[model samples]
Target: MARRKGNNRKKTFGARDDRNNGEWTEIKKDNEKWETYYKAQKFIPEKDWDFFKKTCQTQLPLTFRITGNRKHANEILDIFKTKHLPQLGNVEFEGEIIKPPVNLPWYPDNLAWQLDVSKTVIRKNEQFSKTQRFLVLETSAGNISRQEAVSMIPPLLLDVEPHHKVLDTCAAPGSKTAQLIESLHSTSDEPTGFVIANDADARRSHMLVHQLKRLNSPNLLVVNHDAQFFPRIQIENNGKKSFVLFDRILCDVPCSGDGTMRKNINVWKDWNTQGGLGLHTVQYNILTRGLKLLKKGGRLVYSTCSLNPVENEAVVAQALRQWGDKIKLVDCSDRLPGLIREKGVSDWLVYDRNMDLKTKENRGDIKESCFPPTKEEAENFHLDRCIRVYQHFQNTGGFFIAVFEKNGETQKDAVVDEPPKEEPNSAIVKKMKTDSGDVVVTKKEKLPRDANEEPFIFIPSVHPELEKCWKFYGVDDKFDKNNCLVRNATGDPTRVVYTVSKSLKNIIESNEDRMKFIYAGVKLFVAQRSDIECPWRVQSESIPIMKHHMNSARVVECTEDALKVLLTHAFPTFDDFKDESLVSKLKELKTGCIFVSIKRNDPLKEDLFLPVWNGSKCANLMVAKDDTHELLYRIFGIETTRNEQKKPQQQDEKKEEGKMTENKI
Candidate 1:
C-alpha cells in the first residue's frame, strides 16, 4: 500500500486492502514516518531493523494462560499437557502443519501458552475444533484466560503478595487485573490484601466486571474514575478515618499502540509522532498519581504498549529527574527468567507531526519533559534499569516497563502497610505540570462523584436465614459472619448473599458514600424455595469458600462417570447413580443443597468440590449449563450435550462465560 499524497489532516495515505479470490488482503507492510522516527533513535540494532519491522507486520500468535488458584491452575495444566498437547502436536490440515501450542518459557510453571495460528484457521478448520472447543469452554468456565503473551508480563513483575493492597489504575478488558487478583489469593482461601480495578471509562469499568467475574474474587472492587485524578480513599484505621495507600500499583497508561501492529494492523496507516507526543502528559500524570498513592517502599510498575522513546524512556527520565533517587527504577532483569528484553534507551530525539525534529518553534502540545535528558541527568537516573520488550525479540508485542520502589518496602505484619499521613477526600495535594512545563504541587480540583451505586448492606449475624444456613450448611465459627452482605437500597438480603474480604469490607464501609463501587464479592447464596429448611442455594463460585466451612455430613462421594451423567442430564434420579452408599447418603439428606466430593483421580487429578440440589427422588447439578458443557468436553472427551442446532455456535460462544471465578486457583 502506498502513502496517499496530500491532505490527511495535512496528509494522506494508502493502505488499500486489495483482494484476489478471497485470498488474504494484501495490506502494504510499510510506513515512512514510523520507520524514520524509530531509525533516528537507534533503539534496535541496525542489522535487526528490517527484521523488527518484518516481525511487526506478521500476525501475533494466539496466547492464553491457565488462571485461578495455584492448585486448580495445575490441574488445568495437567489436562492440557496430557490431553491437549499430544493431540495438537504437529496437527495437519490440507498439507499444512498447524503448530502445536507452546508453553511460554518465561511465564511461571508453564501456565501461559502460545499458539501460532490465525483465528481463521482455528475457527474454520474441522481438525482444530476439539482444541477450540476446549479453549472456548474452559475460557467460559473461567479456568483459562486468553491473554496476550506480553500483556501478562507487568503483573508477574509486580510480585504481589497475599497481604498487599494492589491497584490497577487503568484496568480495562482486565486480563492483567485478573492476574493480580490470582496472585493475591495464591496460597490462601481468603487473602488479606484486596484489589481495586479502576478504569477511566464508566462502560469499560462495568465491562471489567464481566472479565473479572470468572475469578469470583470476594476481594476485588471495581471503580470508575479518571486515573490521573483517582480519588484518595479513606479506610478505618484503628477506629479512626485515614487515607489508604496501595502497596502494589500498575500504571499501564494509554499509548500510541504502535507495538500492537502485529495484531492491530491499522497502526500501519495511523502511526505518527503526534500519537506518542500527544499522550505524554496524561501518561506522566497517571504515573505520578500512582506513585503518590503507593505506600513507601512499595512497588509500582509503569508500562506502555508503545515502544516510542518519548512515551517510554523520556517519561521515565522526567519522573526520575523530578523525584531524583527518591524513587528508582527497580532492576528486574533477573525476573521472568526467559523473557527477552532490551535496556531502556538513555538518549533519543523528539519529533513533530510533520516528521521534523521537534523544537521550541514547532513542538505544539509537546511538553519540555518529552526531551532526552542530559548525560549527567541520565547517569543519575540509571535509565538502563527499565525493561523494553521488542516485537522481534520473542515474537511478542512491543512494551516498555519501568518498575519503581518509593523511598525503598515499608515493613508490615506479614500484614499490610500503614499509609503515610494524608487526609481523606480533602483536596489531595500532588504534583502537576504547567502549560509552560514548570512542575508545582497543587490541590487537585474536585472530580466528578458518582451517586448511582447501590448500597452494600451487611446482613445481621443472628438473622433467621443466616442461622438456618449456619445449621444446614455447617458454616462454623471460623467463617466471619460480618463478611456476608447484599447489594440493594433497602438493606435487605431478599436474593443473593455475597462474601467480601475483610480488607474490602473496610474500604466499602468507610467510603461507600464517596466512592463508586461497580462490583465486588462472590455469591455465597441465592434465594431459594421457602419450602426448604435452608432457603439458600450454594453458588458454584462460592464452593471454594463453602468447602472449608461445610462438614463431612454435608458431602456425598461421587465419581467421574457419575459427575458426567449428572452434568449432562441436568437432573439424574437417585437410582441412576451406581453407588448405593451415595444414593443412601442423598436419601438421608434433606431435600435441599448438598456437596458432591469427587475423590482424587488420574483424570480429575485432585479432590473436586461441586454443589448440588437434592430433591425427593433426584439430584440437580448446581453448575451452569455452559460450565457443565465445558466439564463434559474437557474432562470426559464428550462434546456439548445440547445440540448445536438449537443455537448458532458463534452466538453460544459469545454469550457470557459460566460463573467460574478466579478462585478456582
Candidate 2:
C-alpha cells in the first residue's frame, strides 16, 4: 500500500474496537483504504488478492519455538507431543472441525507450533487453557519462547556454527539474538564462537540483556551501537593488533513494520506510504556497514518486517550497486522446506506525495531513493534471490530476507564517505578518523571494567588459598588458570572472578583504550567469607561450562530422596533429610558450594548434576529459583508452595523487626 507523504499529518493512536465481545471483531473489520493499497501492488498475483486481504484482517495464530540448547528441550517436546497433544483432540469452529495443534512445516525439528484457534477460543476451552498454562510456565522458565514464524527465518538462514564469530546488528527485545546464541551452542557444550548483540537504544540493549540472560551462555556479549556506524575492535594476538571481522552478520534492520499487521493492529491506522521511503537510507547504510564488518566468505542476512519493496528490494539493490563484486545474494529457496514465499520484484511503481503513480512529468516529485531499478539493472542485480513472505501464503506475518555472501578479498579500508553523525545523546563514546580513512566508533559502557585501570590479574598456580580451593573441590591442577581473571590486581576480597573465551580475552586487553566493555563473560567464581574451608566458591551459573573440566573432591553423588529435599528447600539442615547415608556423606564435605549428582536407575532417564552450597550447619541449593521449581516438580511430583519458599530478604526482615523491638525496649 502506498502512503502519501505529509508534514502535518494527525498522529493516529490505536484504539480497541471491541464491538463484538465473543471473538476478534476489531481485526475482522474491512478497511478499504488498506485494501486499495494492496490492489496496486504488481508482485502480488491478482487471484491471491482476496485471500491476502482476508488474512491481513484476521488475528494471527499464536506460535512459539522450543529453545534448542536448553537441558529440558527434548523433554519439553516429548511432553507436548505425548501429553499435551493427546488431550487437545479436535476443535470445532464455524461448523468446521479443526485439527489439533501442529508443528510449523518450515521450522526445524518440528519445534515451532501454531495453536490454529483464536485467543478467545483457547481461553474458553478447559483443555486449551491447561495447555496455555503449561506454555506460559515454560516460557517464563525460558525453555520456550512465543515468536512469529517469519521472525525465526533469518537466524536459520544465517546457519550459525559453534566456532564462528557472529553479530546481530539491530538486536533488541532479542528473540533473534537468543536464537543465534542457541545455534552457536547447539552442537557444543562450550562454544568458542562469540555473539555480539548490538542495538542503537541503550534502554532496549538492557532489555536485550534481560531476554538473553535466560540462556546463560558465556560466549554471548551485549553492546549498544548504531548499526549504521558500528565500531571495529582490534584484537591483540601474538603482540599484533588485528581488526575483528564477523563470520556471520544478521542485519535485521528497523523498518516500516507494515508486514506485522496481523499481530500489531495499530499498523492499519498508522500506515503511510512515506514510511518505507523515509527508512530506505538508514536500512541501506546498516546493511552496507554490516557487509564491511563481515569476513571474507561470511554470510550476512538482511531482513525486515515490512512488505514494502522500497524498504526491502530498493535498499538491497543500492548495496549491490555500491559493492559490485564484493557481495552477491545467496539463493535460499531450498533451505526452508514447505515455506511459501514470493521472489523479489524487479519492477515497482514509485508513489508521489499525493499518492499518484509517478510519471515522467512528475518523477521529480517522488524521491529517487524510492524508485525501482531499470530492466538492465534489475537483471544484473539478481533480485530474485531475495525471499518475500506474505501473510496469506503461509498464514504468517509479511517479511523480506536477502542473504549476501562476501566474496574474494576482504575490504581492509572499507569506510563510509561523509558518514552521518550520531544523535547528541547517543551512547557512542567517541568517533575517530583512522589512518586508513575509516571511522572507529567507541561505546560508552564497558563490562568488567576496573575503576583504577588495573591490569587483569590471574589466580596464582601455587598460592595457598588457590591450592586449598583446588584440593577441596578436587579440581585438576592442570586446569588452565590463564582464562580466569580477578577484578582487581591487588585481589583484596574481590567479589567475583570471570573466565572469558580466548578471543574475547584478546579483545578485552587490546581494545580497552578504544571500546567500552559492558559485560564480557560468565562469572567463574565468587568469594564467600562465610566459608572459611573454601574461600573461593564456584558460581552456579558456571557449572555448565566447568562441569566437564572439574574433577574435584567437592563433587558428590546423592540419592533421589536427598535430591528431592535439596530441590524443594532453600536451606535444608541435616535433620531435614530422610536418608542416613546422604547425611553421612554431607558431614564429610567442606563448607562451600559443591557439585551433587542424582543418578537415575531408569535407563530411559538421564542423570542430573546440580550445584549446592554446604554451610556450617545447613546446605543451600545454588540453582535459580525457576530451575529449582521445575526440578522439584519433575522429580518428586510436588510443586513448591509460597509459604515453604524462604527468601533471603525475609530473614533480613525478621532481623530488622527484632532490632526495632529492642530499640523500643
Candidate 3:
C-alpha cells in the first residue's frame, strides 16, 4: 500500500517564504530582445502582449495525464481523489486562500491534473510530497507518464480510433506516441489498427522503444526514417500489394521551441528572430510529405511547440497553396469543449535573417518556396482554423495545433511540383544509368544493423513438441500459432518465440526491402531444454494474455500466506509453505511454470496473478522483482527489505555452485 502523509497541514501558494527558497524562485532573464521582436510583429494582439510576456517568464506548472486502457488506471485515479486531494487542502498565497490543484477541464474525465505551485514548493510541502511520490511511483510502473498539459492536446484532436492506421513522423522521447497507442487501444482488447512511430535519429528512435515498451501493446512498430522523405511502403492486402497510406498522421515537426521558454529556461538566453526563419523550410517539407502519405479523406494533424508565426501559420499556408484542392484545414474549435485557445493569425510580416522586411526588391535572396503567402492567399488558407495555446491563459506550456483533412483526390494526381533534389556527386552519377528503359539508382549506403539479425522463422503449430506442450498446458485452441515465429529456423533447443499481428507481419514481410524496423511485437515464449514436463515455457511478460486464453487446469489458487511466501523467496522448498495442502498440491504438479492466483479479500484490492516454476527440490517465482515487491506489500501486510530480497538470489547461486561440485565429484 502507498503511504500518505500531511493531511492536516495548511498550505500556501505565492507566499514570500515560498520565494525565499532558492528552489522555488523563478529565474529572471532579460526579455527586452523578445519584447522588441514581439512589438514589431502583428500576429499577437496588443491587448494580450503583457500577460503573455509575464507568463513566459514564470515557471510552468507541473502536469500529467493518467494512462488510458490499463487495469490499474481507475485505482490510481481513485488514490488521487481520495488520498492525495485531501492532503493538498487550500493554498494560501500572500495571506489569501487560493484554489488547490485542479484537473484540466478540457481533458476527458478529469484524468489530466495540474499542480499550480512551483516545483520547489511541491518538494518542500509535506502534502505535496505525498502526491508527488504517488505520481513518481506510478510513472515508474508505466501506469502513468509525466508530460506538459499542452503537449497532450494534439493527439486528442487527432481523434484516433482502434481501427485507424496511424503514423507519428517525429516521435522521439515519445509521450505523444504513447497517447496515440492508448487511444488506438481505447475500445478494443486487440486493436486492428497499428501505429508506425518514426524518427530521423536512430538513437532517439531506440529511446522511443524504451519509452513505449511499458505499454506492451503488440499494435505498435518503431522505425528510423527522415520525416521529410519517409519511404512509401507496400502491404499485401487481399492478395494484392497496395501502397500503404495512414488513416491519421501526426506531423509534430522539430521546431525552434520558443513556446517552451517557461520549462526550458535556457531558451531565454538563446532567443533569436532568425531561429524560426531558419527552420521554416524543413518544417514545411515534413508537413508536405505527411500530407502526401495521408489516405484520401483521412485526417492529418500539424503541430509545433514554437510560437513563431513563421513556423506555425506560414508552413501550413505553403502546404495549403501547393495542395489546394486535395487538402483543407479542419475546424477544431468545438473538439475540446473547455480548452482556452486563441485563433491562428493570418497576417504576419516575413523578415530576412537580418530582421529586415523582404519586399519584392530584396526578395531575390529568398527562395520562392520560403516566401509567405500573399494577402488573398492567406484568406483562403483558413489560418483561423488553427489553434494557438499560449502559456498565460491556462498556465501551461505553449503549443500550436492545426488539423487537416485530405480530399478524395489522389496526391499523385495533384499538380504539385516536387521539391528540388540535391545534385549527385561524381561517384553517385556513375552508378545511376538507364537500363531496360528504367532509371536504376544504385544504393548509396548499406542498411544499419539491429539488435536481432536472425531471420523470422515461424514454428509449425502441428509439430510434435509444440502439440504435446500445448495439450499438457491446456493452451487455448483459439490461440493463433501461425503468428508465432521462432528465433531460429532450425530446431534449436532453446530459442525465443515472438508473436506479431497478421497485419503487422504482412507489413514487415512485404516491405523488408524498403523500410528498416527497429523493434516489433512482444516476446511470447522462451524454449527451454530440460528434463521437465514441457519443453516450452511461457514468459512472465506474456502471462497477461496467456492467463485469459489458457484453461485453469494448471492454475493453483493459493492462500494469502502462501502467496506472500512465494513472492518473498526465489526458490522455496516444500517445507517453506505454511499450509500442508499447498505443499501437497504443488508436489502433485508437473515440473514447469504454473499460474498462481491469490483470492481477494478487500473489495478495493484486485487479485494478484503470478507464475512459479516447480522443480524437483524447490520452486522459483518467475515474476519481475518490482512486481514481487508490489504484490507482497499489496496482497499481504508484508514489506520486503533489501537484505531479505537479496537472500533468495544468493541462495540460488550457492545451490548452483553445490550442483557443480557434486557433478565434479
lDDT of 1 at 316: 85
Assess every candidate by TM-score.
0.85, 0.83, 0.81
RMSD of each: 9.8, 8.2, 10.0
Model 1 per-residue lDDT tens digits across residues 1-665: 44433334442344322333323445677899999988888888899998998999898998999977766788888877887788877777768988888889999988999988877778777656667777887898888899989999999999999999999999998999999998998888787899999999998998999999989888899988788878788789787877788899999999999888988767897889899888999999888878878888899999999999888888888888876666888998899999999988888888888887876456676788998788888878888999999999988899889999998423331233332323344533443333335343322222234566555666656666676787788888888877888876555678888989888888877765466678888998887777667777778888877788787487888887788767755356776788888888888988777888987666445577888777777766777667777776666767763344112122222232122111122
Clashing pairs in 3: 12-92
Q: Which 10 residues in a row give candidate 2 its minimum summed lDDT?
A: 656-665
lDDT, model 2: 0.73
| Index of the highest-lDDT prediction | 1
Question: What is the C-alpha lDDT profile of model 3 across 140-256, one tens digit per residue?
Answer: 566678889999999998999999899999999899999998998787647889999999998998899999988777778888888888888668877877777889999999998
- Give candidate 3 regions above 4 Å deviation: 1-28, 31-33, 42-47, 90-100, 116-127, 367-372, 411-469, 486-493, 527-529, 558-584, 598-608, 616-620, 632-665
Compare candidates 1 and 2 on TM-score and give the better one. 1
Model 3 superposed RMSD (Cα):
10.0
Ranking by TM-score: 1, 2, 3
